[model samples]
Target: MSENDIERLQEVLRDFAKERDWEQFHSPKNLIMALMGEVGELSEIFQWLTDSEASHLEGKVKNRAREEIADVLLYLLRLSDVLDIDLIEAAHDKLEVNRQKYPVAVFKGSSAKYNEIKD
Candidate 1:
């Protein structure tokens, strides 16, 4: 229930883990592995469910999915911190690069990667 900046939120999480001496377990490689595991957990929620069925779980079942997703974010944030990656800055930078590679007119309706555009 706090309106904090991303850095503040990350600090809070880091502090919580530090309080439990969990930082020793948070190496960059381990954090990345945990992030992947969390992603798999989140994916399990809709593994076989139809889009309509998955959509219908918006209220109750979503809690499980949210928990898994939160885990993914937590580990990703930790990984970014450990690797000295500024996620927001990197995201903004990548957005600009992607725009060059995938101009809006070419990518607005398609999911193709940069090299897929017809010359």
Candidate 2:
């Protein structure tokens, strides 16, 4: 069920888009670009906000961040739909590979990748 959830979600999104005739504009390239655009927008929300200050932000700023995050995710969901990619399974697969590339023992305390650590 976990493996199929993203596909199911994509299907629901596709249906919703179809209902609104949005499929016509959901080309793979456009969706991918839009996904990046949303990411940039989301990042810009905190571009200069200090981490401590950001942590203290509430209400409107938080809501704006949530909306930006949602926009990024929507574009990602639609991008997955356009590419026929199963994001849940794909995410699981990525995590598995990342586990090997970033074992906890070495990468846990730092942000460096397994390959970047000194042997």
Candidate 2 — what's its lDDT?
Answer: 0.83
In angstroms, the error of model 1 at 40 is 0.3
Give the clashing residue pairs of candidate 1, or none: none
Worst 10 residues of 2 by lDDT: 1-10
Worst 10 residues of 1 by lDDT: 1-10
- CA deviation > 4 Å runs, candidate 2: 1-8
- Each prediction's whole-model lDDT (CA): 0.83, 0.83
| N/CA/C clash count, model 2 | 0
Question: Model 2, range 73-116, lDDT digits (tens) per residue?
Answer: 77888887788777887888999999888888878789775777
lDDT at residue 8 of model 1 (Cα atoms): 76
